[model samples]
Target: MARPSLREKIIESGVRTLHERGYAGAGVREITSDAGVPQGCFTNHFRSKEAFAATILDRYHERTQAIMDGTLRDKGRPPVERLRAYFDAITERLEAAGWRYGCLVGNMSLEVPEQSEVLRTHLVEVCRALTDAFAEAVRAGQDAGEIRGDLDAGDVATFLLAAWEGAMMRMKVDRSPQPIEQFKRVIFASILAPGVKAGSPQ
Candidate 1:
């Protein structure tokens, strides 16, 4: 029941502020105001805006990873189903946010390069961790005959991440969830389809 410190408050509110406004739009003053702390406190706690954003990215990654772990690592559920559940959960999150904010890592990957390399490195870590989890899940599905194994799991995971991130960008551009839904439909039906093994032409 203890209160969050000023630094913690910035990171907590900074995550939402950055997600909503992006790197260029999210000002330190705005974040501090959202956190209910003075703007001057930001410099006292963090060296610069880039350093603050790195902390926010780490927090965001931990949160999304927890969600992924809950659905993807549930041994009782089939691996493919678990994959669907993970996307379903993400869809709900995007819908709840009125489709305004996409994944923090994806947002930063697009918006932050002009700002700082340090933060970009943090973004890369978030992306790699997500791909690793997806790859493991895909491998599990292949083992259980729930997903095709003709394609390398790592390659498939990389493709899925790339496609999904691109679709998320599309969603933001069009301000519609249609792109994400289409991605889910085609990806599940073709790539992750059960017992799908590519063979020679008949």
Candidate 2:
């Protein structure tokens, strides 16, 4: 087999380091070492740490899009169900990871947005993509009359994304699922039809 592409190696290593150590804590040497690539290879692949981090964010956005594409493309499911299922997928992933690693996008937003413009630029792109995907789902639900039509889908999408990120952070800090459960309750109240209660016995 061909040697793995340098770009792929760098991005994979960058994401792994960022996930395990957070942005500020992960160094180029550490990432390259973990990837089993020489330190010189990192410089050859990326102009700087921020550049590599941007590429890492882009790779994450691609992976996230792929996961969501699979979830949202379930043709037999209703829009509301699909939307809920999308959140369910995220919850399952966090639970599986033991909530040790929250979203890379969210984690980077906290760690590097102030330190690196390149990182912040990539984050802005990620937020845009997430908001666009969310708005599409919200629009679908609105068309189906499952979500309130009075809301701006784009704005609601932004809010929900922010809320989800916050819930993930809270879950990580608290080491409990209560934050996510509370978030789900708020989501149900905000997005679902009237008279629908939410969360499991909370």
Candidate 1 Cα misplacement greater than 4 A, ranges: 193-202
State each model's CA lDDT, in order: 0.85, 0.82
Please, what are the lDDT tens digits per residue for candidate 2 over residues 76-107? 66667667778888888889988788899999
Against the true structure, candidate 1 reaches a TM-score of 0.93
**Which portions of model 2 miss their true places by more than 4 Å?**
1-3, 73-75, 195-202
RMSD of each: 3.9, 3.2
Q: After superposition, how far is residue 56 of candidate 1 from its true place, in Å?
A: 0.4
lDDT of 1 by residue, 14-123 (tens): 99999999888989889999999999999999998888888888898899889888888777778887788888899999999887788888888988877788887787
Worst 10 residues of 2 by lDDT: 193-202
Structural similarity to truth (TM-score) of each candidate = 0.93, 0.91
